[model samples]
Target: MLKIRLKRAGQKKKPFYKIVLMKSLSKREGKHIIEFGYYNPLKKFAYINKLLVYKYLNHGCYPTNTVRHLLYRLTQNKINVK
Candidate 1:
């Protein structure tokens, strides 16, 4: 099944994450279908393409726990890192 999750990136200490769409069993930083958002925990920043996110959501895409929390924050306009 297609799933939405975070792909770790950036340097060792400063971690960055790309919110991506990919096969459930794929590797964490492996090939992804698409990248629709990003998160930088240290900076308390996040960005998400709501249009694409909701589109995939309606099409049965599942988001990880962390991504789900981010989405909730997005909907509430709490973490607008764009």
Candidate 2:
């Protein structure tokens, strides 16, 4: 099953995350099918590709709990699209 989840990145104290698409059973830091967004909790920053997200969602990609919340938060915060 494909899933949308966060992949840990960045430094020790200063954490960063990549919002990626991958298999549900895959390793957290393993190869991702696609990386379409990112989040930095410390910075209260998020960047999600709405088009891709919706596309994947329609195609049956489920977001993890954290990713779900972040998606909600993205609507409340200022998102930076690239």
| RMSD of candidates 1 onward, in order | 5.1, 5.5
Specify the highest-TM-score model's number.
Answer: 1
* Model 2 agreement with the true structure over 1-82: per-residue lDDT tens digits: 9989999999899999999999999999999999989999998999999789878887778888888788877765433322
Find the 10 residues in a row with the least total lDDT in model 1.
73-82
Q: Write the per-residue lDDT of candidate 1 for residues 1-82, one digit (tens) a residue.
A: 8888999999999999999999999999899999998999999999999999889887878888788889988786432221
Error of 2 at 33 (Å): 0.4
If scored against the real structure, what TM-score would every candidate get? 0.90, 0.88
How many angstroms is residue 46 displaced in model 2 relative to the true structure, after the best TM-score fit?
0.4
Q: Rate the local accuracy (lDDT) of all candidates.
A: 0.88, 0.87
lDDT of 1 at 58: 79
